[model samples]
Target: MVGKRQSRREAVSEHKRELILDAARQIFAEEGLDGASLRAIAVRAGYTPAALYFHFESKEAMYAEVLHASLESLGSAVDQAVSRTKTPQQKLKAAALSFFQFYAANPRDLDLGFYLFRGGMKPAGLGHDRDVRLNAALEAALRPIAEAAIALGAPQERANLLMVDCFAHAAGLLLLLHTGRIRMFGASAPDLMEAYVDERIAQLVQE
Candidate 1:
């Protein structure tokens, strides 16, 4: 009876944690990071501020959880996209398309996942373990593209360089696109992304 009671308690705890995350995601989407407060999230989750504290020590802790979840989602999309393609060039193009589409569709998630503007800023209470996991998840998302480049005759070092270049190029454009900067030039984000992926694939084929 004690074991069954403990299992039920654990399940309940997990469910509540998920509820908090869902509420946080919505709030963050509506109001970037700074605008979303713990009180707002707690209310949205149908819990008191104290109850939210029991699950997450601070807003930073909760944000870290949300960021990690977003990274995992992007990583999964990349893996699935690559899996659908057989050739190296096709895999690279698919991975790029999957990445662009995911971020384009979920602008908030993209903002949460990419911390380039933050300049090494991490959420408070995000320990070394969380940092390692975040980096691992991000690398996993880009691994297929790098591997594909290697298979297409680029040396390992060259392939790694290519991966970094591709990511920086795409992410820079995406950030501009997200902030409506690209609109100044009368370009569509999806169209720009598709063309960028095509150019990358062509480069891979040539080298």
Candidate 2:
């Protein structure tokens, strides 16, 4: 009976942790990192501030947790997108397009995963672990495109560089779209992304 009770308590603890994380993600997405408050997050999670402190000692800790989880989910989405294509070239294009589409459609995810609360706030212990995991998740998301480039006759070093370049290109376009600069130039975000993927695929194939 004691063992069962302990298991139940652990389960509840984990559930509460997830709830906190979910609430934080939503709040961070809506408000950005600088604007989100711990009190707001606790309220959204339906937990008191004291209860939240029991799980995450600080706002930075909670942000790190949410960022790590977001990156993991993003990595999975990219991998699944790459898996749908059979050819190396198709894989490369699909991977890039998937990444572009995912970020474009989910601006909040782009902000949290790539932009918010990541610099200057050094987390100790578990925060360090989360950083390590975030880097691994980022690499996983990019590896498929790099691997596909290698299979298409490019050297591994150059292929990896090419992947970075591709990401930079897509990311730049997305940034412009997000900031409404793309609209100023009378360009459509989706059209630009499609064109970028086609051009990039051709460049990779020709190299």
Highest-lDDT candidate: 2
Question: Model 2 misses residue 53 by how many Å?
Answer: 2.5
> Residue-wise lDDT of candidate 1 within 145-176, one digit each (tens)?
78998888888998888778767777877888
**Per-model C-alpha lDDT, please?**
0.82, 0.82
**Stretch of 10 with least lDDT, candidate 1:** 116-125
Runs off by more than 4 Å, candidate 1:
115-128
Would you list the clashing residue pairs of candidate 2? none
If scored against the real structure, what TM-score would every candidate get?
A: 0.87, 0.87
List of clashing residue pairs for candidate 1: none
Q: What TM-score does candidate 2 get on C-alpha atoms?
A: 0.87
